[model samples]
Each structure stands twice: as C-alpha cells, then as structure tokens.
Target: MYKKSKIALAIGLSVGLATTAGAAETNWRMATPWSGGPWLERDAQMFADHVNDLSGGEIEIEIFPGGTLGSALKVTNSVKSGVADISHNYINYDYGTDPTTALLAGHSSGLTPEEFMMWMYQGGGVELYEEYRRDMFDVVAFPCAILGTEIFLHSNKRVETLEDFQGLRLRTSGAWSELASRLGASTVVMSGGDIYSALERGVIDAAEWGSPEMNRPTGFQEVAQYVIVPGVHQSGGFLECQVNEEVWTGLSEDEQDNLRLAGKLSVFESWLASSYDDLDAYEELVSGENEIVHLDQDFIDTIYEETAKWEDEYAEDNEWFARVLESQRDFKETMSAWPEYRLPIGTMGR
Candidate 1:
C-alpha cells in the first residue's frame, strides 16, 4: 500500500534533483520528544526520508530529537504557529487542549494500530479529524504513527494490590496519570531523562514507561529492581505527526499519500522493534542478574479492574471522549460476532 506506484520514477527524479546544482533546496524541520534510540524518533526520520525520495529532493526534511526545539508539551502550538513544519508528540500530552484527544489516543482500548487506521482512513476517523482540527485550529494533523502498548510497571517495591500503590511515588505520564490519581499514588509526569534521578533520589518508588526496548536505554535495570508485564493502561495507542495546514494542502497527492503510507510502516515497525527489544531486554535483565518479578494473574487483574474504573470516571466527565469510545465499542460489537474480526490481528501475531 505504498503511496508511490513505483520506486524507479522516484529514484529517477531524485537523481535528476541531485544533478540540479543551482536548484534552490527546500528543507523543513521535523521534531520529536524521543531521542534517537526509540522507533518513535526513527519513524520521524523515516518520514523525512520518504518525503525526500517521493518529492525527488525538491523538499528536504531535517529531524530534531528530544524536543530540541522546545518541550514536547508545546509541539502542537509549535506546529500551528509554524515554529516547526513537522513535529511528533502523543495526544496524551495535550489532552487538556481537548479531552476528546484522549479518545484519539486510545484510552478506551478501542482500535489496535492497524484496525484504527481502517477507522481513520476508510472509516470516518479521517473525516472527523479534518473537521475537528480545521474547526478548532488552523493547523492540519492526522493519525500518523499508532504506537503499540507501552511497558508495564517496573519498580523497587512490589505492586501486589491497590494498597501497595498508596503513598508510593511512581513515575507515569498522560492517561496513566488518570489511573494513578485514582489509585492514590502521587504520580509524576517527567521527561524520560528524569526517571533515573527521580528513582535515585527516592522521589519515586515505581515507574511504568514505554516498551522494554524503549526503556532499556534509560538503564532501568540499574535503577528499579522489578519488571512487570502486560500493561493494561495502554493496549494499543495512537501517536500523531502534525503538519502546518498550509504545508499539508500544498503537497501533491502523491506526497500526501506517501506520508500516510510511511506513517503506517513506522508505527507497525515501531511495534515490531519494541517486541524484539523487550525480548532482548528481558533476557539481559535475567542474565545480568536484575531482579525480575512476574505479577500473579490476580495482581494484574486487580490493576485492570481499577484502571477500568478510572477510565469510566474519565469518560463521564468528557462527552466527546464518550462518543468516540461508543463508536469503537459498536464496531467491536460486530467484531465479536465476526470470527475473522479481531482487535489488531496483525499486531497480536495471529
């Protein structure tokens, strides 16, 4: 499903572009909160690469990592004001901007990344996206990369039940904060770089971050001594890349399609990379003598039940979120009857 019909023409145009010595170059700035390690940042680079190839070097994209331009919290405004031509940030970071955005980020556990695309592209999600953003802000955005489930809780102290979370400072971000607020733990949302210091200073006792692969670079093994699996808070989530409205509309159909196609690959491959990294990280954690604890099924179940309550309370306060949640639920209703229909079959590896 590549946007480009063939690579030969793109490459040919690119070659011609390289020969145009006096040609004025077109360059755009792309930014992401993640540094170069995780696939989130890698996906940004991939998008830039595709733009260059598809545009025949008529437009060049340069990527900035770890919010080099500014805090990840500011990326939305940054895109709107044209401070940056392109930027990647999770919808969770700005849920207050529009609580509906939380549903956009998959808090209700609706669509898997690929299934969500069906909802976004062919389904009405894409149209809704065009309507909402255009109405609210002048910028244009889409569900670019849909990041898979993040990692489970890994901590110095055991998380056996709801009581264990009480008074235990944990490092969490976005929607997880909703669960934490309900669980009575003082959850702190900090940049990835802050996890180590927070743990070392005893500012936090537990941390649940991205996939194991994504967190390995943070050296969690050296800090927190426990690892827990099956992150119930985030099943399969959506991550977006936003472009200035003017910039988006100016693209040729092929360029727009290329961006959409590249985004799909980025999210899918990011999930694959995460799985591989998690496997390897687990092995290293065990072999490297890091303490690894497997939460009993009961423990995980308790977490899920409590997490569900938080989600319910959340949706009650946010009507738009409720609407999006209901849509996905109805879609899933029919899916339950259709054996061939499932939640992100491609991701779960059926």
Candidate 2:
C-alpha cells in the first residue's frame, strides 16, 4: 500500500509539471490582409516562424490569411480590438484613420527601398511610427517587411503618354487615388481581391496592385494587356506587424526583443527575396502576351513636380503630416550627396 501511494504521488507531480510548461508558452493569432500565395503572405509566415524560433518555442503565432479573421482593410483594427493578437499589414491601409499614415507606407515618387530603410532604422522613423500608432490606435507596430517598387498600372487600354491618363478609370487606393484624380484619371477604390474582376468586366480600365512578383500570382497578365512600369506612386514601402497593446505589455523583455529582432530579420529577408523574384517575374511577363510599357522621362518628371506640390499643400493642413513629411525631406536632402560621392558616372557597371 505504501509503494502504490508513492507511485501515485509521482504521477501527480508529472502532470503538474506538464501543465506549468504549457502555461509558459504564449500563443498568438496573427492576421494578414494578403492572400496565401504572395510574397506578402510569405513574409508574415516567415516573421511568425522566426518569432517562434527566436523565442525558443515560448511564442507561437498562427497566421490567418486575408478575410479569415476580418476584412483585409480592417486587420489592423482586428489587432487593436483583440480579435487578433497581431497583424501583418500595409501601413496605408489605415489611411482613412489618418492621412499621415500613408506617408509611412510610401508616396508618389517617395523614398526608394534602401533610403526608406535608412530612414526607418537610422532616421527615427520607427520611433515616430510607434508613437503615432500608440496614440491613434492603441496598438504597437514594427516594420516587418519591405517591398520593392510596385507596377504602376496593369491596363486593358494603352497608356503611352501623359495625355493617356485623361478620363481613364483607374483602381487604386490611399493617396495614389487622389494623385490619380489630379492627373485626370477617375479613381476607383476596391480591395486587392476585386481588382482583377473589375478590370475584366470593364468596371475599371486600369489598376496598380503590387510589384511584378507579387502581381504574377494574381494572374493579371491574363486580363490586362498593358503592364506599365516605374511604379512612381509607391517606389517602395514597409509592411508592418501590429501587436495588441495589452498583449505586448504582458511579454517579458526577452520575448519583446525576440519579436522586434524577428521583424528586422524578416525585413532584410523580404527585400532580397522580393527583389530577386521581381526580376524573374518581369522576365516572364515580357516573354508572355502582355505588352510592357515604360513611362516617358517627361511623364515621370511631371509626376515628381505634382507630388511635391500635393505634399506641401497636404502638410499645411495636418500637424503629423507636416512633421513626418519634413523628416523624409530632411533625410532625402542629407542623402542627396550619395550619387555624387558614392556612385560612378552613369550609375552603371562597377
């Protein structure tokens, strides 16, 4: 009888230990607005995986693709409201909440991918982002991914010159919609999922989705004949990971550091992967049926002029907009010496 009682006590201790171990592991739901196959979705999964590894299995994040947890545009709100513990999303998706948010996501003829990274890590952009989101939405955000320039437009009709934009119906979002309207194009706002159908049915004449690799999986090539290049509107931008404030505050210092490091690593990985894949995807598109169109230098120059005007006008109204815009412009000016000092003439082969 004594031996049996000892054995039972040992079993009870084992069960208690197991329960405590399980309790120590933190599980989080990560929501994203991207569909399953794109690099954007891959970045989300990669960040989650990295977090799990970095935290040594203490943090486990499960990703819910677009529309699984909530509407694509509302995933950030889902994180804010605790429907999702975290979210991977473009910062501009929250443009309706504050127009300044769009600047963080990139703008027409804005920062290049490399310069944007410089501004983010070196120029205090990250701190500004954290402050802005925390004050406005009660969530914590980190830049988890960075994408190369997007395709300017995939169109059913040809757009060879500046005049071609006049009266054209275009599907776009955020500040680009306003910029497109300014250029005499009628702007239509819709989710990424709806763009293909709208173009197919003649509801919209053109749309700008993402980079070459990101757009390939959507099969825009099947329905759109003209693929415009030099995506001036969104030269490059960062995608962010937003964490619920309560959940973030609950994490240990080590766990929080792990999450931040994971985000930084994911950004580095995404830049290389997306840039390489874009090259392959661009090659494939050129070989396919779609006609590749490059915007003329004059057209691009005009866009740059209009963008500066629009930004200055916008800055005059909103305080945050003015602040962030000034930071970006200062960064641009500080880095303006790069071409003269670091690059050889023509910026060609080494």
Candidate 3:
C-alpha cells in the first residue's frame, strides 16, 4: 500500500510536468508610459534578458517603446485583460481601476524616495494589494523603478507663493492634483505626451514632470523657463511592474523567484542612477544655458511641512491613502537601523 501511494504521487508529479510542458511559450509584450529613453530602454531590456535567461528561453518578452503597442493607459488595461503579458508603468495612471493601485505610484503621501522604497518593499504596503495588484492586475507587484523625488513648479509664470498658484493652468495627475487645486492651481490633467505641446503653446502655464534625464528628451529645455526644486507635489514616485498573469503562472517557482529578485535590483539601480542625474541636471540648469530659478530654501522647508499636513488631511478622507500612509511610516521606522549598518561601512570602504 505504501509503494502504491508512492507510485501515485510520482504519477501526479509527472502529469503536472506534462501539463506545463504542453503549455505555450510564456512570451509577453511590455511597454512603459514615457518614451523608451535611457532608463526605460535599459529596464525593459533587463526584464527581457533576465526572464529569457532564467527561463532558458521558455519565457520571452518583446519590448515595445512608448506608443508602439498602445498608450500607457492601454498598457495597464491590456495587461489586466491579458492583452499584454507585462507592463512597466506608473500605477497611478490607472486611478480609475482602483484607488489602491495608486499607492506605489507616489502621487501623494509624505514619502521620501528612500521611505517610499522601504514602505513598498518592507512596509507591508504592497501586500495590502496582494489580491488585487497581484491577482486582478494579473501580475506580481515588483517595485521596479523609482524616478527619485520630483520638485513641483515648471511654470510659464513665476510662482513665488502658494497663492500665486491660483488660476494658473497646470498639468497634473493623481490625487496630488486635487491637493494642488485646493492650494490654488486649476489642475489640468494630461498624458505625458501632451505636456510638451500644451506647455509650449501656452495651453498650460506650468507642469510637473520629473525624471531629469527623461525630461531632456521632450525639449522641456526649450519652453519651460523655470524648473523648481523640492517637488512638493511628488516628493517621491515609483514605476510598477505588471507581469502577465498566465505567463507568470506558467513560470516555474525558480523563474518566478528570479523575476522578483530582478525587479528589486532594478529599483535599486534606478535609485542610485537618478541621484546622479539630478545633480547633473541641477548643475546644467544653473550654468545659465537655461533660465533656471531656484525656489528659496526657506520656501522648500515650508512646502514640505505643509504637504505633510495636507497628506494627513487627505488621508482622513481616503481610506486607501490612510492605509498607505500608515504602512509607509512604519516601513521608515523599521529601516532606521539600515543607515547605521550600511552607509558607514560603505563610506569607509570608499
């Protein structure tokens, strides 16, 4: 009877392998919201390389640069409906799909770049959507890339004070736009593609687009006279990885593990890489090639404090925001020990 049981178990395992073998190639299509510039191209390539390498060519994802397959909006929905196998986008782009999806997108909430990373990875924030983000979006939640922190105010007009934002036509997205409206600005929602023409043509006086390297591709240099620092609107933001559900489910346990590891590494890469870019951009902006204006440091301190208050108040109304904030704050506290352990040793080595 024991031998019979062993034989039955072996047969079941064999059948499972046979079923997986009969499954089709785990090929996928992947795209990002922004045009496939340096970071996007590198990230998409990393995903393809790692997945293909780990899967032994069983799973392949063809990279589509911006608008090649469809818009950023379409990409998210496409992945959801299994029209696409994977996606790289800001989850906040799908604010309509579910408010909670925006948690990692980093539109609001008083998260610094490191805090946001910690919150998403160690803070139990992503787990809140383990069902919807992991299942409904038909993908695993990989906090793949971070745009660093953004500074608000790329205005056609000078915004010296919060009151100066009143009646100013500005381009924004996510819950932060609502906060901008409350503060004074008339918010005009836009896709990333539309921002350039709108700002150039004076359709909008100001806009907030981060990622210093990415903005260079759009010729924001040509039109927008001023770029302010300390992005009050987006102190931090993130890019989400939405793996194709069927393709992911088909992956062996080892392959799934590699994909996740790859995602976390990608986020670290983004974090390290963008810090350099911001410094470089700031140097260029101040070189007088561009008419860059720095907001007063005092003003920045004020912005940070006020936004924190706004975030708490905003959380009061939105249950999702409240949960995200609490989760993120907890993550930050947990990581307080990390700086002591990691930074000092690294600096000594350097």
Q: Which candidate is the best by lDDT?
A: 2
Q: Between the candidate structures 2 and 3, which one is better when assessed by lDDT?
A: 2
On residues 13-82, what C-alpha lDDT tens digit does candidate 1 reach at each position?
6553444334467788876676667544555665556556655666677778766767766777777877
Model 1, residue 314: C-alpha shift (Å): 4.5
User: What's the C-alpha lDDT at position 10 in model 3?
Assistant: 50
Candidate 3 lDDT over 112-179, as tens digits, reads 77777767677665566454576455566576677666757677787766656669898987776766
Q: Pairing residues by index, what is the TM-score of model 2?
A: 0.90
Q: Which candidate is the best by TM-score?
A: 2
TM-score on alpha carbons, each prediction: 0.81, 0.90, 0.80
RMSD of each: 4.8, 8.8, 8.6
Cα error, candidate 3, residue 100 (Å):
2.8
What TM-score does structure 1 among the candidates reach?
0.81
Sort the candidates on TM-score, descending order.
2, 1, 3
Q: Rate the local accuracy (lDDT) of all candidates.
A: 0.66, 0.83, 0.67
Q: Which of the predicted structures, 1 or 3, would earn the higher lDDT when compared with the native?
A: 3
Predicted structure 1: lDDT: 0.66
